[model samples]
Structures are given as structure tokens and as C-alpha cells.
Target chain A: MNDVITLAHGAGGRQTAELIDRVFKAHFSNPQFTGDDAAVLSIGGADLAFTTDGFIVSPPDFPGGDIGKLSICGTVNDLSCMGARPLYLSCAFVIEEGFPLAKVEKYAASMARTAAEAGVRIVAGDTKVAGKGQVDHLFITTTGIGQCLAGVHTSGTLARPGDVVIVSGDVGRHGCTILLARNQFGIDADVTSDCAPLWGTVEAMLGQTKDIHVIRDATRGGVGTVLYEIASQSHVGIHLDSQSVPVHPSVRGVCGMLGLEPLYLACEGRLVIVAPECEAPAILDVLHRQPYSQDAAVIGQVTAEQPGRVILRTEIGAETMLPPPGGELLPRIC
Target chain B: MNDVITLAHGAGGRQTAELIDRVFKAHFSNPQFTGDDAAVLSIGGADLAFTTDGFIVSPPDFPGGDIGKLSICGTVNDLSCMGARPLYLSCAFVIEEGFPLAKVEKYAASMARTAAEAGVRIVAGDTKVAGKGQVDHLFITTTGIGQCLAGVHTSGTLARPGDVVIVSGDVGRHGCTILLARNQFGIDADVTSDCAPLWGTVEAMLGQTKDIHVIRDATRGGVGTVLYEIASQSHVGIHLDSQSVPVHPSVRGVCGMLGLEPLYLACEGRLVIVAPECEAPAILDVLHRQPYSQDAAVIGQVTAEQPGRVILRTEIGAETMLPPPGGELLPRIC
Candidate 1:
């Protein structure tokens, strides 16, 4: 079997099998794999939760992470935000011709390490190769299966009047970092795109409050869009104070220079939560205790009046409706 | 809430939601899709099966199908072959900028219709737009979830001595059709690719026999590669009669003219089954009852001697080990 992958490696034959057994299984294999159609695991009467996401970030490799880590954490965080116990993942990669094996290996290794760190298994996977220029280096699709604990009911449409929307941590870090990495912008800033699995942080928050109504990973459209969605879904209004939202100085500085709005940029490691106002402090306390959640803040509050609207309180105390992003301001920044 | 998709359709905001609600959700919405972080489904009291595949076929559309149908059926067939009752699918689309809305809609509608006909629900989905040239046109990633029936356990590694190999139908039609469509060698053929979903045929076979030891879709490298995989996985020898394997005359003619081997050409709606010898004839009979399986036949038999080898009995009665195709003789045929 060839250690290096060619187009034939994904041609559904000996090379494909060997690649699966050697390169993939050798690194991510575990007992739960079962070699069956699906991983069979007992969840002690918990509800089954499944999430699937695709990573098509250009360059495949980025400053903080590559497609592999994104593939793993993207779905794992989806499960986490739903308060599920992340368990297993199925990865499917579509690589373009001429993609270097060394890069693929690096990405695969990162995925294996990330899955291990998150206490999950990459149980099964599929791979395909497309002609050159048909795909952007490589694309990864990950499907995560987890178990939702009993009494854990989360939904975007569950927020109520007088609910608090807390952003788990800093924003715009990921978007700014990727932007700088791509454009060769000479910005001397210690910023790493926040790409991480949030199951641990989610677990800590769940320990403090079961009344959390909604949880959303602010990935694509950032906190502002996520808040707007929650407000619309929950049929409520959301109010955010400019000072309360956690935005790192670097992100703000970069946004100021680039005329970019941090609220419209994507973030990986951060989550937005809407909960009863009374439970906001306790929830923030639990989140603040973790290193990943140290910068968590009470960014906003949910209100029943003027449902389906989101308002931002400016520095001068004037409020303005914050509309959803008109378009993808930054693509593939995730 | 326009029915037609715009450039801002995949922007992850009002337009994205409207597209989901107006077009996608109209066709795909089920009780499982609660507009949440993930779909909630129950797999209790049943064995769960999962499979994922990506489609990046060139031209995006072909004689009989497009990336849409391929994405749905590929994973569905994988699940179906495992004797699993596929229930839900997650669709992820990576669309290139400036892709014709009509073309994308055609693909999406095809997918939605295929899922409906296959008796499965599109429970959750994601959409992303890439810059022009980032993707050829559109690539779709689909993940399927199925429930394995009680008392039915099937695997590629289960074939044993005295088992029989059954092919559901003719081969090479898909590959030849795609070749013709590409106008390779200035050849034109009115033949349509065999791109139908195989769930119905598979369900019929499962209804007749639960003793199927192995089932594989004859794709990519085709029959030779599929049997080789089963043999290696099951550690059994497979003996095939070259003359017994059914190939449509049109496909054979195309292959002969192009110096291509029909045995290594792809087939979309086909399955290779290894069954107990006593059940082979019944399986063939059941398969042939379906229009798509009219050419179903007992192409080979499993043997213990010389395990992990696939031997072909030529028309002249001489036997030779059939090697798996080194690479895809035809690419993007699926």
C-alpha cells in the first residue's frame, strides 16, 4: 500500500481501504468503531443528538487551525450547545487533485488529536478526490453523534421576556486573524482565532443552570446575527449594551482599521446563551470559572416587547436596531 | 421570502432563513427539524446505522442525473446495502458564486424529490457559498442515518466458503453514458446513465432473505474492485464467471470501441451481494422482479481456498486472478 495518496487513493479500491486502515484508523481507531454501519453505544436513557457540518475554508491550512480541527470542533460544538455529551464523529473528506499528502496527514493528525481531547471517537469516514480546480484544496464534512442528557431541552425559540444573552467569550478574534493571515497584513498582534470544542465549557454551564433557553455557536454571522436569530425564533426583542459585549482590543483595533464590524465576523470557540435574567449571574459565574470562559460577559437581555428585533445600545446611550448582516462580509474566515 | 435563491441566499441571515422556510423546509421539514442546533431523533430499541459521502462530479449534471441525485443515492445505497432502514439525511451544499439559480434549484429539487421517493426525510442541512472558481459549480455532502433491522447483521467481511455472489443488474452503463456525455472521442450515445436510487430494490431483497453475508455498491472501480474488497474483508476467495456477469450490449459496445473494460466501469444503481448458496437463486429471482434488476444474475461464488483472491473464469474456460483497477479508468462518471 502506498503511504502517499494519489487520485487512486480515493478510487474505492485497495488504496482507499489501505488509506482508511493505515492513515485514518491507525490514528483514530477505537473500540467503539465496531466496524459496523454505525457506532453502537448506550447512553443511559439519554436522547440522541446528531449534527453535521462541512468545512470548505480556503488554503486548507490557516493561522490557528486547518480544516481538520474545524471539522471536529464544528460539530462537537453544535452538540455541546445543545447540552449533549459529545461521543462520536464521522468524517468525510473531498480532496482535490495535487493536494499534498503531507498536508492531508497534518490535518488528519490534528483531527485525531482534537477528537481525543474532546473525549470522542472518529468512528467511521469516507474520502473522495475531485479533479484539480474542482475543489479548494480539500473540503471536510463531519457528522457528530452525542447523547442529550435527560431534562436538557434547548432551542433557539425558547427565549422569553427579561432573559439575558451572554456571550461566552471574546468575539471577532477568529475572523480578524484569518483576514490578516490571508491578506499578508502586517499587524503585530497576539491574536489566535478561537477554534475549539466547547463541550467542557457547556458542561460547566449546564451544571449551574438547567433553565438556559437557547444556546448558539456564533460562527458564521457572529454574535449579532445569532442574537437576531434567537430573538426572531423566540419571538422576543434583544438589547445589547456596547460596553458589556466582550471584544478584545486587538479585534477592535483591526476592525477599526479595516472598517469591519466585529459583530458580523465569525467566531468558533464562543457561544451566545439566552437565559432568565435571574439565572444570568450564576450561569456567568460557572462559565467564568473556566479558562475558556474567563472573558464571558452579560452581553444583552431578551425582552417580549417589540418581538423579533435586536437593538444595540451605543456608547452615547442611544439604541439602534441591529439588522442581520446583508451579506457574507467575510467568507471562509472560519 | 422569495422562492428563488439569490447570491445572499447562503449568507446565514434573513435570506438564508427565508430560503430554508420557503423552499427547503417546504419540502424537507419534518418533526425532527426544530430549527435548532441539531436534529433530535430516537434510535432506542433499534440498532442504528450511519453513512456519509461527498459528491464532486464534474459538469454537476449528466445524462440521467446530477450531483444532487448522486449525493442522495450514494449514501442511501450504502445504508440500504447494510440492511438498514434509512430514516433521515443531512445535506450540505457548497455552491460557487455566479452559479445559475435555476441549476441549483434543479439540483435541490432533485434531491428533495429523491429523498421523498426513497422514504427518507432531509432532517437538517447547511449551505455555503464559495467565490467563483473556488468550486467547479456545486458540491454536495450528504449524511444518512438508518436503523438496522433486528436479526439482520451484514458486513463486507462476512462472506464464507460456499457462498454465492449476486449482481443486481447490468454494469458499465453509467460510465459509458458519462463518457458519451463528455463527447470523448467524438462519440455520441443516446444511452442514459443508471443513476436511480436502490433503496426499493434493496428493501425487496431484504424482505426475501436476511442471510445476506455481504452487500456492496458496484461504484467507482466497479465490479472487480467491489468483489476484491469483499474478498479481502471477508478473507475468502471469490470465483466469477466473466461470461455470467451481465453488461448491456450498448455499454459493451462503447467499452470495446474505447478499449475500456466493462468490468471496471461504474454503475450507480447496482449492488453486489454475497449470500448463502441456497439463497442465491431466490435472491436473484426477487431482484429480477424489479425493473431495475431485470439483469440480476449469479455472477460468482465464494470459496475458502486461496482466500482474499478474486478469480475470473474467462469465456474460454481459463481462470485468472482479476486485479482491482489501479486507478479509476473513468473519473467523474458518478
Candidate 2:
């Protein structure tokens, strides 16, 4: 590992994982500490899922959602990925001193709205103001606890050969939006983040079926990175029908102009799901009817060949390997 | 309300309370949300306590403890105050890019040790690295879920006239330590932080009896602020025997030199306990036997004479009202 921290360490890519493995996981590993979006624990004769996420998005706000909205959606989606019903959330904020009170109030109100939309209550919170320049604008860390829906089970390790790979909606919009918000490339497009609370989307899909094997929100790292992680965890190959993957036109344009791969860009409101091929039809049927997943589609499938790898097929017939997720995408993009 | 945040907003004093009320409370209030150390919720037929705290202590490492240890203690102590058995904790970190990897690892080790001593599992965690110059070295936010101790109920609102007020140990060591660490005063004192996880202390005391009415840790604004909060919550008066209060000789000497009130300085390892006078002897006995609270002493008693206020009886028997907690004492003092 490198001796000093870097932007890549917070990019939610391979470097982040390496750092976590070398530092936190070395000491914090225990019976209930799973590297999944949330850890599922048996509490009071019931299964509960708990997770936490830190949001330090640069600019704090963008089209579609602000940092406060993103903070709530991020954690809620983690629980939902575990097939849990988002229940309660606790937030801790470290605000830069002299930050506008109106901005703080605006963020708080946004949090309340987002929590309500996700069917979760903001039950506890703490705020601390750091001296100006000690911290950038503001940061919010949210922790969520949810009830695991009965009879529903999902894990990254559950992907298997013959399982269908489904994405809930168009991918990479969130990343593209943040990239342009930075205006580092002197490019502007009408791209908005695909940031939204996704518990309802997951709940509505699970209502129609329970045989799903894996469900993970594609966040910090995009759908491509998530699929790579799932492949390694489940020891299966992922075969992507590249043309079937969906991407918003504006996002595609932004990525094209910047020579960025949309597949590797972040997606705040999308899910990479693996389930029995037979159940794919039903899952797609339900997802298409939901607001957030209307563009849901089967973009790939799990394969027995080339274990722990992802292969992308061209629209014509050529086959190529998708490079492993690595390096920093965009710091504080979430 | 100020147009911009001041250090006082994070001082955990009157200004902090006002900010919480005007901003957070206005939007985040819900049935399960109380302005206590932690919020109590009924989950899966079992009562639970949930809390979140952010640690942004400057000089990350103080005389007696580091940010990692302080973070764990803060949340653990919060749950302990709610009469809950600390169970699971989720931590989120925001580190400055280029921060030393060894320091991060050391802090993680400290967190592990503290969590082990508190008998809580570090079940979930997240890490983010902000660009250099955007954040001071590092900040950590920990959220905890604890199983409420059966038959034990403690709240600031439960204090009644005639209840005894107890100090678990000598106060002000933590604040004094941080203040000296800043090296602003140039007055060197052999003082160390009283930072420690107090679940075991609270557990032992509760095990002795569940008759305890209120329990609170003296953190940012110290014992004085806590007493005032409890007085306002319970609509009662606290009359202190100033001479009976225990302050470490070193801390007292430093405060005496600085014209600072020991009662207004923070103590991370102490608790301000309230209970029926009949149970004071037993509580004091248990507290004394515990390593963390060997200096436990009865410092005051609840009174009906001055509701929503704290009075101090001087050694010469002259009584004066303790000033309300206000202003920013020491920023980033944890």
C-alpha cells in the first residue's frame, strides 16, 4: 500500500477496497462484520440490517439532488440492497464554521423529505462546527437500520451460473452530473444525477418475487465495478450484452466527450441484480412498472467460464474483457 | 439565529442548543427523536437505543487518548447513558488526502481496543478521503445501536426533587488536556484526557439497582451544561455543594491559573448520575469499586427552590447561581 493517502482512496474503487482491507478490516473483523452494503444481524428474534455512509460531495448540490438528499438515499439504498425495509436513520454532521445557516437549514429539510420518501425516520442526529478552513464546506454521515424483509435473501456471493444480470435503470448519470458540476472539462450538458431513494423500488420488486440471489446498489463505483466485485465474490463470470445497457443521452455525450466509460461511472439510483434466469422476466416486469426502474433491463448474465471476470460482447460479434475497476473516478462524487 | 455558524454552535453549550432547535429540531423531529444522548426505539419487540456522534478533535491525538478512542467512547457513553447495553457500532471516516497511513492504522487499533473493552462490535464502517487542504487530518463519526437494559429507565426528564447528584470521577481533565495540546496558553500542566468507554461503569451501576433516574456523560460543555440541561428537562433545581465536587489537582491548578471554571471544562470519562437519595449510598459504593469512577462522590441534590437552574453553595456557605452554559470554550475539543 502507498504510505500516504490519495484521492483514489476515497474514489470507492479498488484503492478504497485495498485501504479498507489493510486498515479497518484488519482490526474490525468480527462475526457480524460483512463487507456487504449492510451487515445483517439477528436482533430480538428478528433480522436487522445496518449500514453507514459518509457524503462529502464537492459543490454539495447538483441537479436532481443535493448532498443531504444524496446522503439519505445512499444509506437507504444500502439497506434496500439487502432486501431490508428502511426504518430509522441517524445523522452526524461536521459543518465548516461560518457556513451559511440557510444552507444548513436547507440541507436539513432536504434530509427530512428524502427520509420520508424512503419510509425512514430521522431519529437521532449530532452536529459540530469546525473552525473555518479546518474542513471544507460540510460533511454529513448517515447511519441506517432496517428490518430484513421476511423470506428475502440477497448477497454479492449469491451470484451463480445461469443467473441473469439486471440493472434497475440507466447507469452512470450520477457520475456524469457530478463531473459536469465540477466544470473541470469546460463542458456543459443537461445531465442530472440519477439520485433517488430506492427502497420503494426494491420493495415493489421483492413484492412480486423472493428468489433473487443478489442485489447491490451501484454507487461510488459504477455498475461495471459492482459487477466485477460480484463476479469475484461469487466466483462466476459476467457476460455483458453491451448494446443492451442503457445510458441517458446527455450522460453518454458527456462521457464520450471526456473519453470516459459510462459503465465505470457512478449511478446513485441503479441496482445490479443477479437472479435465476427464469425469474428475470418477472423481475423485469415489476421493475418496468416502478418509477425509478422504468428503464430496467437485462444487460448481462452470469457464466461458468472465466470465473471472476467480466466479458463484454460488441453489438456486432466481437468479444472483449472489461478492465478491472481501479483508480479514482471522482473524489466526493457521492 | 446567526446568519453564519460560529464556534459556539458546536461548543455543545447554549448556542449549540439554540442551533439544534432552530435548525435540526425544526426539521428532524419525530416521535422517536429526543434531544438526549440517544433515542430509544422499539425494534422487533425489543427496546433499543440509537445514537450518533461525530469526532473532529484537533491534534487528533491528545495526552491520554486519540480521536479513534474518543469516537468510540462518545457513542458508547451516549448509549450507556440511556441505560442500554452497547451492541453494534458503525463508523464513517473522512480523512484528508496524504494523511499518514500509520496514523490511520494506529487509530483503527485504538478503536478496536476501545470497542472490545466496551463489549460492542465494530460491525460496519465507511472511509472517504478528501483532498489535502480540504479537511484537517481526519474526522470520524460513529453510530451505535444498543439493547435497552430491561427494567432500567434513565432520562433527564426523570429527575425529581430530593434526588442525589453524583460525579463518577474527577472532572475537567479532557478539556484541560485538549486546551494544553493546542499550546495556545503556554501553561504546561501534567494533565491527561479522561477519555474512556463507560459502558462497564454504567452496567455495574445499573446492575446494583435500576432506580437511577438520570445519567449523563460530561462532554463538550462539561458538567455545568449537563446539569442545566437536566434541570430544564425535569423542571427541577440542582443545588451543588461546591466543595464536594471532585476535580483533579492538576486540572484544578490549571483552571485556577486560567480563570476557568472546572465545572465548565469537559470530562470524557465521568458521569453525572442522579437517583433517589435512598440509592445514593449503593450507587456510590458500586461507582467507587469501578476503576473508572473510584473518586465518585455525591456533589449535589435536586431541589424545588429554583426550577430550571443550578445553584452552588460555596465553602463559606454563600450560595450563588451558576452561570448558564454559553459561548465557545475550546473548538474541536471533542
Candidate 3:
């Protein structure tokens, strides 16, 4: 609705949704188009998922990973969220005129390692350079193709009452890491980004049961945003036992000092999963054995009442509605 | 290699190839990785082609096309070069914080129109915003997946001795258009960009024959760079009847005035097609009937005598080698 684009339009929130609806979806409407992480396509008897993401993180390097690692994780997680195994990736880079070639090599090395770890091939790519001041240091846009797992269907709209909600790992570490990396708040906290590829974690969960209800990555706007999205899309209420939500100690310290909600901070490697409560034990059992998801736990459940709302039960037993996810939280966190 | 990235590294010439080899290919190499327009992928029972291109053409708008249209055309043409029918496209945009929403909408509309013409669906997309002054308005990256034609095969390494080289249309218009749009040289010319979605042109040629040896779009370093690439890849020399290379009058005028070689300029809508001399008639016939290639003409022939070289026979019947392609031609000209 704004005449000019704002940072909120890229914040993965309500404004981002509106822009997609009014501009992109309005013009690019078609049968196979998807608002989910990836578009599912039936090609030559194979079900496939295709997705793309652009990374413009302010500080290219963070505590746990650089832009290259983050870029691969972002797209791989998107495919994983669709119950798809990422197979191929294409990377396109736009480098500013005077950026260091060694840094480029470093990023490429990181990407190669990440892609190998994810069992995905880097098949095609393009590179362009903009004159100095015309672009930031570097930006990467990665597109991934994946094979959708048979007998498994996961979508934000599939959440149902009585389904248990699971967090794959500690929340808000990535957002907290980025904030600290920028040093805008003059805070020194020993927080590292949760920026790992999640295909293995998702695979572990699906190995237990293919009857998962919804699976979504908490990337730009974090677990709180992901929950709000699933709740609205599935028309189910999310009731969170807020005290049970996992938060790393340093991240909790940073959030407490900054007066920020840990739930609303970004998590590059975390997943907000909803599945039948009966299957939660098996899913959690497998997740607990996984590398990136050792902190997996059931922190909430889908509710029949208060549809489209997220209610949090505090430690003192007071209940409050989680703020609807919107506005500019932080730009370029991923 | 330069310690820092230079404009030449992204100019799609020798320096660009060096960067790709020393950095990207060294790390990302795999059986499916490609140096061609698109990577040939076998999925299930169908052969597929996947490609990605980044468009950072400065000014965003030009005479005949905007960045949005150019993005679609670039990806579509890349897939078409592989004799593939482009099916699905994923677009990602990186926008500056305060770019006009209307411009974004306009570009989206242009992309929709071009994708419709190319018979491809825009299925998925992501948007990220950089802080103001951190980016040059916006950059778009489009990734396309296409079904490879059943009986056709094309590659830069497939050119053979005695094959004829053909230009799909007038050369250098896109480059000329961008040069004028920038107003770097104060020349008033009527050149419009040759930027177009060219799947139809390739389709028409394939319908006539499936034995096309190689197809390449002339962007960045233009026909000269593409020719040089093919010459070395296929270990063949190209002998050009220089006068026969088609150049629109306005474009010719601009190049003549600027002392720039039209052969080294970009053509977004043109194709540098190589095929057996015997197959030239049918390929040229169909190209002539196509909208994008109406002015298609035979420009040269491949020879085994001088491998890895390109010789030009001028109008006065003197032979000279065309300069090898390298260095910065024009930055961010798509």
C-alpha cells in the first residue's frame, strides 16, 4: 500500500505478504504457482520442488557461518520444509566492483562444502559485477531443485487441532547473532548463529513418520512468525507453553537486555513443525539424535478455539496473545 | 588472477573464464556441472535443462526492455539454447530499501508478459531488501527449468569442422541500446535493444531439424566472446566473411562512430548458432520465419586449420584475426 518499497516489504511479515499478493501473485497467477517454500511440480512421473532465495545479509560473516553457508541452508531448508530432498542447486552472484577475490573464493569453498554435505550438486551459475557504490559487497541468489518424498505431504495449511507443535532447536540465536555481529547495541554476548542446513534433521523426522501435518523453517521472521503463518493458513489456534520454548543462555541474556522476544528472532536452522500428538514421541526421538536438532522439543499444540491466534501461557500462569507477526523486525538477517 | 574482483571478471570473457575455473569450478565441479547455457539434467525418465542468470543492468529500463523483461528473456533464452522448452521459472529480487513500489510492479508486469510469451510459468520467488545506498535500485535473478527436446542435443563443445556459423539477427543492438541509455557517449541513435524471450525462435528451428550443433545467446561480451568460447571448446577456428555479419544501420552507425567492434557488442535477442553446412539451409529458413531472427544471416564457417582462433575476411578480401575477447567491455549491461 505504500508508494515506495520499505524494509518491511522484505521483512518476511505482513507487508511482505501484501506485496507478494498485490504485485507478484497478481501478475504471475498460474496453476503451479505456490506461496509455500517451494513449488511442487509433477515432471516426467517425478514429483519435484523448486525454490529460490536471495541473500543480502549486512554482515556477510557471522559467528557460526558466512553468507555462502547461510545461502545454501536457506534454500535447502525451504525444500526440506516441503518434504523434499534437495538434489541440485544453481548459484548466481553479483559482486561489487572492488570486493576481494579471496573472499569470493572463501564463499565458494563454503558453498561447495555445504552443498556436498546436503547431497546436492551445484550444477549451474552466473556472475555479474556492479560498479563500486552500485551494490553492497556481494549478494547471492540460490535456486534449488528437489525430489518430493513420496507418501509425505507437509504444508502450512495442514495443521489441525490436537497436533503438537515442535521446535527443531533453540530459537532466536540467528537473529541474536546477527544483531551482535552488527554491534549496533554495544552488546557483547557469546551467541552463535543457528545457521546449519536442515535436510538431515527433516529426513530424520520423516524417517519416523510420513504423517506430519505442517513443516516450516523459521528464517527471516523466526519461529513466532512461522507459527503465526501456520495458524492463519490452517485456521487453527496455536497455544504455546512459553516457558518450555528453548533459548540458548547467551541469546536469552541478549534478548532480556534488549527487551526483545526470543520467539520473534530469526533462526536459520530451526523448524516449526506440527504433527499428530501421537507421532510426537517418535519424531522427537529421531530429532534428538540429529546434529542440528538436538534441542528439539514440544513447546506448543494446535487448538480448536481462537482460530488464527497465537496464545502464550507465561511462567506465572498468565496467558497473553502473541503479537501478530508484522512490521520491520530486522532487515537482511538472512 | 587479480587479488580483487575487477569489472573484467564479470565481463563474460577470458577474465571471467579464469575466475570461474580458479574459484567456482575448482570447488563446485561435478559431473552435472556445466559451462554451457544450461546444465543437462536427467530426472526420472525425462531429460531436463536448468540454468540461472543475474540481471544487474544499470538504469533498470532501456529502449525496448526493462530489467524485468531482460531477466525473463535471459533465462528463457539460456534454456532454449539447450533445445529445451522452458517450463518453470523461479525469480528472486534484491531491492534497495526505498525503491519505488510502482517500478517494482512495472517490472513484475513485464516479467509476466515475457514469461507468458516464452511459455514458462513463474512459480516461485523471494524478495530481500538492502539498506538505502547499499544497492543499486534492484537486481533480479531468474532460474529456469525446461524439458530437453527428445531427439536434440546442443553444446558449446559440439561444433564441428565445416559447420556454418549463423547470426540470429542484427548484431550489437542491445549493447548499443545500453550505451546510449547511459548517455556515456553523446550520440543520438535509434537503436533499441534486441532483448526478447526467444524460446519460439529456438522451437521453430528444432521443429525443422533436431541436429543443431550449438546455440548461444550473445550477451555481456557479445558474439565475439561467444565465438571465441566455441572456437576453443570445440577446438575449431571460425573464418568470418566479416561484411556478411548483420548489423542494424543505427547500431552500425553507433559502433562506427564510437570505434567499437560491433562483433564484440551484446545482442540479448540474437543467437550465435553453429550447425553442419548441409543443415544451414533449413535452420536459416526457420530462423527467417521467426520474429526474433528475421534478419538472420550466415556469418562464418568453422575450420580445422586454425584451432582456437577466429579470422575475419574483410570486404577488401584481406584476412585478419579478430581480437581475443577479454577486459571490461561495458559493466552491468546484462
Candidate 4:
């Protein structure tokens, strides 16, 4: 490992995994330590899921959400991915000195509203101030506690051959929105962050069936990254039908202009779910009835052939291997 | 509140309270929202304590500990303050892009070691990297979940008129150490931080008696701030015997030279405990036997004379009110 950390170390891809393996995992290796979205804890004879996420999105506010809402949604979705019902969340903020107090209140209000919508309580918080240039405008780290539903289990390692893969909604909206929010490219396009709490969506799916294999939010590295993670974890291949993948028109246009692969752009509200082939339609039926998952579509399937690879069958029917995610593409795009 | 946040707003004193009241409390007002160290949660038919704290201590490494050890100790102590046995912890790190990987590893090792001592598992974690100047070296926020003891209930508001106040050890070491670490005054002192996980100390005390009224760790604003908070919350007066208050010789020398109040300096490993007068000796006995609290002493008693006030009685028997803490004294002390 390099002596100094780089942007790629936090990119939520291979480099991030390597850092975790070499540093965090080596020291914090315990029976309950998690490589999954959340840790499944057995407290007082009941299963609970615990997770934390640090949000450092630049611009603080984008089209659909700000860091506060993103902070809450990020952790809520993490617990939801573990088949848990979000219960209580604790937020810790490190605000740069001289940041507007009204803006902080605005973020808090957004957090409260988002927590209310997700059926989670914002119970505990800590605030600290850093000197003007010591930190960015603000950063919020949210940790969540969730109760695992009975007989429900989901993990990245659970992906299996013949399982259908579904995405909860359109991809790349959040990353594209943040990219445009930076305004470095000067590209004019309509894009909104797909940032929302996914507990309700997960709950609805679990209510329909408990046979889900894998559930992961496509956050930092988006759908492509999550697929690679699942493939590596489950030792299975993923075959994507590129034409069947849902993408917002604005996001598609932005990606096309930038020559960026939409598949690797981040999404805060979407989920990549793997379940039995027979239960895919049933799960999609439940997801379609939900507001956040109305665009739910089966974009791929788990395969026994070519383990640890993601093969995309393009719209023109030509098959090609999707390159694995590596170095940082967009820093602080969480 | 001012239009923009100032350093005093995060000082953990009067201004910090105002910010919490005007912004966070106003927006996140809920039955479960906390004004104490940690929130008592009832999940899955079990009582659990949940809390979060962000550590941005400058010069990340210090005499007795670094940011990593402080991070674990902070959240573990918060849960311990709630009379909860520390169980699971989740840490989120926001690191600057160019931080040294070796330093990060050192911090992580310290965290792992401290969590092991506290009997807590680092079950989940998240890491994000900001641009070179967007953040300081690194900031760590740890959230913990602990199973609340069956019959023990401790809060800042539970102190009674006849309760006795105990200082778990010599105070002001942590804050003084930080002050000296900054080297702004060019004065050298042999002081080290009192940063340690206090679950063992609390566990030993609970083993002695569950009648303890309150247990608070003096962190940012120190023992004086904690005492004032308890006085205000319980609506009772605190009478301190100034001569009986324990202070290490080096800490006292530093404070004497700097005209700083030892009572107002932070002590990371110390506790300001309140309990019935009859239980004081037993509690002190247990604390004294423990390595961390060998200097435990009964320095004061709760009184009904002046609610929401702390009176210090000198050796000559003259009583004076301890000035309430306000504004910023030391930034990033914790």
C-alpha cells in the first residue's frame, strides 16, 4: 500500500476495498465485523442491523437533496439493504467555522423531514466546529440502528446462479446532478439527485417475499460497482441486458455528452436486488406500487458462468465485458 | 442565533446549548430526542443506549492517546454514562486526500485496542476522502449501541438535593495537555490526557450500587460545565468544597500559571458522579480500587439553597458562585 492515501482510496471500488482489507479489516477483524452494507448484531436475543456513512458531497445542496437528507438516506438505505426496518439514527456534524447558521438549520429541517418519511427517529447528535479552512462547509456522519425482520436475510454474498437482478429505479441521476452542480463542464441539462430513504421500498419487498438473495444500494460507485462487489462476494457472474436498464432521459443525455458510463454513476435512492427468478416478478410488482421504486426493472441476472465478471449484452445484441471499477472518477460525489 | 456560526457555538458551553436549542432541537424535537450523553432506546423489547460523537482533535496524536483512542472512548463513555454496557460501535471517517496511510493505520489500531478494552465491537464503518484542503487531516465520528442495564437509570436530571457529588479522578489533565500541545504560550508542563474507556469504572460502580443518580464525563467544557448542566437539569444547587477537589500537581501548576480554572478544563477519563450521600463511600470505594479512578473523592454535595447554581466553598469557608461557562475557551480540545 502507498504511504499516503489518495482520492481513489475512498472511491468505493477496488481501491477502497484494498484499503479496508489492509488497514481496517486487519485490525478490526471480529466475528461481527462486516463487509456488507450493515452489521447484523444479536442484541438481547434479537437481530439488529447497524451501519454508518459519512456524507461529504460538494455544493452541500443539489437539485433533489442536500447533505443532511443525503446523510439520513444513505444510512437508512444501508440498513434497509440488510432487510432491517430503520428505527433510530444518530447524526454527528463537523461544521466549518463561519458557515451560515440558517443553512445548518435548513439541513436539520431536511433531515427531520426525511427521517419522518422513513419512519426513523433522529435521537442523538453531536456538533463540532472546525476553523474556517480546516474543513469544508460541513460534513455529516449518520449512524443508524435497525431491527431485522423475522426470517429475512440479505447479503452481498447471497447472490446465486439463476437469480434475477432488479434495480429499484433509474440510475446515474445523483452522480450526474452532482457533476453538473460542480459546473466545471458547463453542460446545461436537467438532472435531479435520486436521493431518498429506501426502507419503505425494502419493507414492501420483504413483505412480499423473504427469499431475496442480495440487496444493495448503488451509492458511491453506482450499479456497476455494486454488481462487481456482489459478483466477487458470491463468486457468480452477472449478465446485464443493457437495453432493459432504466435511465432518466436527462441522466442519459448527460452521460452521453460526457462519454461517461451511466452504469458507474452513483445513485442514492436505487437498489440492486437479486432474488429467485420465479420471485422476481412478484418483487417487481411490490416495488412498482411504491413511490421510490416505481421505475423498478430487471436489468440483469446472476449466472454460474464467468464468475467475478459482469457481461453486458448491448442494445445491439453484442456482448462485452464491463470493465471493473478502479480509481476515483468523481471525488466527494456521495 | 447569529447568521453565521462562530467558534463559541461549538465550545460545548452556553453558545453550543443555544445552537442546539435554536436549530437542532427546534427541528428534531421528538419524544426520543436526547439532551443527555446518549439516548435510551427500546428496540426489539430490549433497552439500548445509542449515541454519536465526532472527534476532530487537532494534532491528532497526543501524550496519552490519539484521535482513534479518543473516538472509541468518547462514544463508549457516552453509553457508559447512560448505565449501558458498551456493545457495538460504528465509526465513520472523513479523511483528507493526502493523509498518510501509516497514520491512518496507527489511528485504526488505537481504535481497535480501545474498543477491545471497552468490550465493544467495531462492527461497521465508512470512510470518505475530501480534497486536500477541504478537510483537516481526518475526522472520526463513532456511534455506539449498548444494552442498558435492567434496573439502572442515570440522567443529568436525576440529581437530588441530598445527593453527593464525586470526582472520579484528578481533573483538567486532558484540556491542559491539549493547551500545552498547541504550544501557543511556550510553557511546558508534564501533563497527559485522561482519555480512557470508562465502562469498567461504571460497571464496577453499578456492581456496587444501582442507586447512582447521575454519571457524566467532563469532556469539552470539563467538570465545571458538567456540574452546571446537572444543577440546571435537576434544578438543584451544587456546593463544592474547593479544598477537597482533586487536581494533579502539573495540571494545577499549568492552570496557576495561565490563570485558568482547573474545574473548567476537560477530563476525558474522569466522571462527575452523583448519588445518595449514604452511597458515596461505597461508590468511592469501588472507584478508588479501579486503576482509572484511584483518585476518586467526594468533592461536593447537592443542595437546595440555590437551584441552578454551583457554589464553591473555600478553605476559609467563604462561598462564591462558580461562573457559568460561556463563549469559546479552547477550540478542538476534544
lDDT of 2 by residue, B1-334 (tens): 7899999999999899998899888998889987999999888897889999999999999999999999999999999999999999999999999999999999999999999999999999999999999999999999999999899888999999999999999989999999999999899889999999999999999999999999999999999999999999999999999999999898989999999999999888999999999999999999999989999999999999799999999999999999999988878988
> Which 10 successive residues of model 3 chain A have the least lDDT summed?
A200-209
Candidate 1 ranges beyond 4 A from true positions? A1-46, A184-188, B1-45
Better of 3 and 4 by DockQ: 3
Clashing pairs in model 2? none
Q: Give the lowest summed-lDDT range of ten residues in model 4 chain A.
A: A1-10
Model 2 misplaced stretches (Cα beyond 4 Å): none
lDDT of each: 0.73, 0.93, 0.94, 0.94
Please, what are the lDDT tens digits per residue for candidate 2 over residues A192-263?
Answer: 899999998899889999999999999987999899999999999999999999999888898888899899
Ranking by DockQ: 3, 2, 4, 1
Residue B278, model 2: lDDT of: 98
State the DockQ, from 0 to 1, for candidate 3.
0.91
Model 3, C-alpha of A19: deviation from truth (Å): 0.4
Candidate 1 structure quality by residue, lDDT tens digits, B1-334: 3322232332222343444455334433334333321222344444566777778776677888888888888878877877777776776667776666556657767886777678776655555667778777778888877776667767777899999998888887777777887765787666777877788898888889888888778877678767876787789999999999998888888888888888788888888888899998889888889867989999988999888888999999999988654533666555
lDDT by residue (A281-319, candidate 4, tens digit) is 899999999999999999999999999999999989999
- The digit string of per-residue lDDT tens for model 1 on A195-222 reads 8888889888888778888888888767
